[model samples]
Target: MCGGDFMSKNPEEAMDFLSYVADVSRGWDEPTKGEVGKMKSQLNAYNAKAGM
Candidate 1:
């Protein structure tokens, strides 16, 4: 499993990472879809914090 700590690097990096995650999460089950949504929310918060 990959550690989410990598997301703290920078807004651009986080956006790219989340975009990849969104792509990979496509067609996933309901629970996994929920997780992806949570991840997207986190990424949004991070971007906001970074003024992206």
Candidate 2:
């Protein structure tokens, strides 16, 4: 695992965006949380596609 993996092209900006996403996602509960987690997991595929 590397910081670069989660770090976007713009380090400062990406951390900020990730923090915002975390804050919003944390508010979710149960069924909604699971659904959102699934979507977020799908987005994880982007890392593979980017060859990270």
Best by TM-score: 1
Scored by CA lDDT, what does every candidate get? 0.80, 0.72
In TM-score terms, candidate 1 sits at 0.42
Q: How many residue pairs clash per model?
A: 0, 0
Q: Model 2: residues >4 Å from true position, as ranges? A: 1-9, 30-52
Write model 1 residue lDDT over 1-52, tens digit each, in one string. 2385875668887788888888878856455777989999999999999999
Model 1 off-target regions past 4 Å?
A: 29-52
Clashing residue pairs, backbone N/CA/C < 3 A, model 1 = none
Q: What TM-score should be assigned to candidate 2?
A: 0.39
Largest lDDT belongs to which candidate? 1
